[model samples]
Target: MGMQPMEWTENALIKRSTDFGKLCALHERDPEAASAKLETMMQTVRTMLEHVGVADVNNVEQASIITEILTKKFRAMHDREPETTEETNLIRSFAQIHARVQQAHAALQRQNGDKDTSNKSPNAPHDNAVPPAA
Candidate 1:
């Protein structure tokens, strides 16, 4: 039987939230904070998933799921307007990260789909193929 999929338990969510907060704290003060933080955030997520046994950290579907979860958590937790410059910076960085993640996933999906079509057998029947004569 195929292995069971990893469950996103409460504990895992809490741990990820804490990690994200810490990462934001560390990057919010940097000069190129937004870009650097976004890059680090992506890498951190990839590392987190790799450690948790996700077969492919760069898998488009997995990345999309993680991005969606994180985006929801972030919106819920930071619903209020930013009260400080640091908070504003963090939010901006998060927005950029979210947008980039979405774009990357779309691109990867398209690339994979193209490869799938290209790899199809030459003799395989396609939707547009003409019917054979009796």
Candidate 2:
């Protein structure tokens, strides 16, 4: 047997992120679009998950965790939506932005992985990153 992979125990969603400004600004400015985006993302993820099993449950669960945090942030804004917290503005905004980033990241991964060749050395430089001078 070989060394297994390690699992993240914390919020892996935004842990590595240091930037999300433009989308977040748009989220704050045009909340309606953000709401629609959130709903669409949730539906997309939910639909994709319909065919997955326990082994693939991590994605949905991660989204849920992010939703909880976003809900709390929404509450912190003090504009509590009594009738429909589920449809709150901030929560929707956060979900919308997060979903967009996640989708883009996945697409980038697919694009990058498409170029990975078995003949390449494991220690070789990544195609996306600039290589150092010789």
Candidate 3:
């Protein structure tokens, strides 16, 4: 079977988080160039979402909040901001939520695997019966 809904959500979240980290790394390596690239990519993502007809204002709001928090953290880390206590705390909160979501996804995957294995026929081919790699 394909990935469950929760698995897909977790994987997407992880990928996005990694993408953000890569963006931050690029910024560290070259701030001016990275900022321009980040801005372009952000606009691209927004346009793509709009094209897909997912006109959810909540999603847009969430994206804006996340972007603000990310920008503040980046500025603070680079000493562009003298202090960023609130932004730092927001980042920490986001990290905690990310971890919890990941953990829940893992648990769901494990539960699904166990259920499938228990339902498998003994005569089924072992390789064919195994869950596909994530």
Supply candidate 3's per-residue lDDT for 125: 43
Q: Which candidate is the best by lDDT?
A: 1
* Model 1, span 22-114: residue lDDT tens: 554554466466456666766666544444342332553454456566656555666777787866765675566555554454444344554
**lDDT, residue 126, model 3:** 45
Ranked by TM-score from best down, the candidates are 1, 3, 2
TM-score of each: 0.42, 0.33, 0.34
List candidate 2 stretches off by more than 4 Å.
1-12, 15-28, 47-52, 56-63, 83-134
| TM-score of structure candidate 1 | 0.42
Put down candidate 3 lDDT per residue, 61-125, tens digits, no spaces. 34444444554555555665334564455355445543433333334434455465655445334
Computed on alpha carbons, the lDDT of every model, listed in order, comes to 0.54, 0.47, 0.48
Candidate 2 weakest ten by summed lDDT = 15-24
For residues 1-134, what per-residue lDDT tens digits would candidate 2 score against the true structure? 35333233465445312112233345568977765765664554444333222343355455545445555544544455534564455456556645544444344434456475655444334564444459
Error of 2 at 122 (Å): 46
Candidate 2 overall lDDT versus native = 0.47
Superposed model 1: Cα runs more than 4 Å off: 1-14, 21-43, 46-58, 113-134
Task: State the weakest 10-residue window (summed lDDT) of model 3.
Answer: 1-10
Can you give the lDDT of residue 106 in candidate 3? 39
